[model samples]
Target: MMRVVPLQSSGVRGHDNANVDFVRESFDSEAFGIEIGRIRAAYATSAAGYRLLFKSVLQRARAEHFQQVLRRTRLENLEEVWALEATGFEMMDVVVTFARSVAPAAALPVWPDLRVEEATDETFEVIAHERAAAFFVGIMEDRPAGYVTCVLHDHTGEGEIELVGTLPEFRGRRVATRIIERALPWFAERCRVVTVRTQATNIAAANLYERVGFTLRCTEATFRANVATALRAQP
Candidate 1:
């Protein structure tokens, strides 16, 4: 079973394969690049007995993907830690944090070249309308950058940066920070703390969060991939 929740609020599905095809193709590409080699075994259990198959591609791919992520988001050469007041527990920082790397694996095709768009897009408006705040679309140059879908609840008392992204072509230019800078005022009014959560394996993201005054509340192990000699084995 597969599902996709856009902006984490609504689940969007389609009968046609084209929609899912884009997603599946991206997944296969990412899996092949990072996790394809890790498949060890596959098995299924039933009331009658157990069956094992040597096709743990999904599992292996996940493991390998995460391992690479862990390596990239490593805490190295961290220099400073800054903080911004969003509300109470909600805070923003611009130090060495890793919130930049928590995006879905499908976006990996354009990884590193990504940048955030602070302008409003179609997706941002959908979320902002429900939350009653203005939606902003993050942009990189003339192209449409990543979009952040979020709003302030309870007035300015609670603010959420639901989705922030940096497209593959515009990364490494501090575009996420540009988005953060634009949204701080909304956060400062009501929320005690401004918070963003992402994958722990995303070192760039973690560093970005830290730089923006966010603290590491917790780290969870999610999303795994497999690595095999055929996949990651040295040529």
Candidate 2:
């Protein structure tokens, strides 16, 4: 089983008040009959702190025969001293925020064969498969078409769009948009803001949010390193 260690503060925040965490953990190494460990820094961790953390992880990896050690960092936070070239890169994710006050009047789409409804336990199970603060499902001719799950933060008056998806056959029909439109009023009543995150590379998803009046807030990057190689080169 893959195991994750709790994030540890690195006490380094770059110019933007960004901080980083040192993450070290193990996974089902023995299941595969090989020890696999991972070490990474998160957020705005300082370069010095990352090196220190990496050295300690390297020592542990050697003694434990760890077959692999993975490290991840944000592109912005990455420093020259880490000395680990990125093998691959994934586009940063973009965060978008919407406000209830500016939300347009709920003009639900009228589909001749499709209808929007609150998700029942059975429908919710088929869609989200987990308990959600609130959920909405779209049904087309008695068949499940799409769904969206929402979680509300009462204190912050923020509502999160945890998941939204549509069956492949229902794509390009605005099934997702309608489901989200239907849920907005519900969210607006109780939450001041609604937020969602999507990969920056997902232009379709970004366009969808823009059509719904969500404003782009920020983006975050992801970086990776092979600690096993770094340690082997150590003299």
Candidate 3:
């Protein structure tokens, strides 16, 4: 197989627990700069040639004092999986992206005391720095129960649900679902297709999206290696 696009997000597995701020500074690294995501090469005529390329890249990353390294491939790419395993990389996580068309919907219900509304300056702090995105919060009795962060790409005609979360105490109450339900109309006004991603291991999250009319789009495997440890492994 041959390599293609090399875009990488800041090493997040797309889980709700991941604290990716989506700020440019968080992704910047001065120590080592190469293609950080989706590294692949042509299939090896012999196993030796392919494995050597991975070795060379990992070694260089380590030499540059990078603490950790990551690569992602589609789950169907067995050759890439095996190559990663052979080169001392361990599968960190698998993530699935889901998409749904945003159509006018009958309003979904929320708890009587729980208010699902767009975040205001006082309720959401991130809005101070990020003006283009939208935040919906589940406020029960004036206390924040959960929130969903969304972004619209006008050029692409798409909206991305960047993060979905509910406080630990608020779990199982459908707070997340209600917040997302509230966010949908906001997206519908700006884009037709909305997408969200969550870890494959998160069954509850996967099911939640489906329940909300999202269909599975794609899944990718992320492999991680400690720079020094990978370099020390033999073969």
Candidate with the greatest lDDT versus the true structure: 3
Tell me the tens digit of each residue's lDDT in model 2 across 168-192: 9998888888888887877776666
Candidates 2 and 3 compared: the better one by TM-score is 3
Q: Give one clash count per candidate, in the order shown.
A: 73, 1, 0
* lDDT at 192, model 2: 68
lDDT of 2 at 127: 41
lDDT by candidate, in order shown: 0.38, 0.58, 0.68
lDDT of 3 by residue, 1-235 (tens): 1111222333221222322111122222432453232343224433344456566666655554565667666878676578678888899899999999987667655668679877657436443235337778798768889888877754366888977888999888888887888889888877899999889999999988998889999998878777678888855
Candidate 1 lDDT over residue span 1-235, tens digit each: 0122222111122222111110122233454563222111112232111101111232233343532211111222121000001000111222222222221222212224444434445554444444435444565555666555444544234456656677877677776765665555544544555656675456777776677666764432222222233234322
Show model 1 residue runs off by greater than 4 Å: 1-123, 127-134, 153-157, 220-235
Ranking by TM-score: 3, 2, 1
For candidate 2, the lDDT comes to 0.58
lDDT of 3 at 60: 58
Off by over 4 Å in 2: 1-45, 50-113, 126-131, 153-157, 224-235
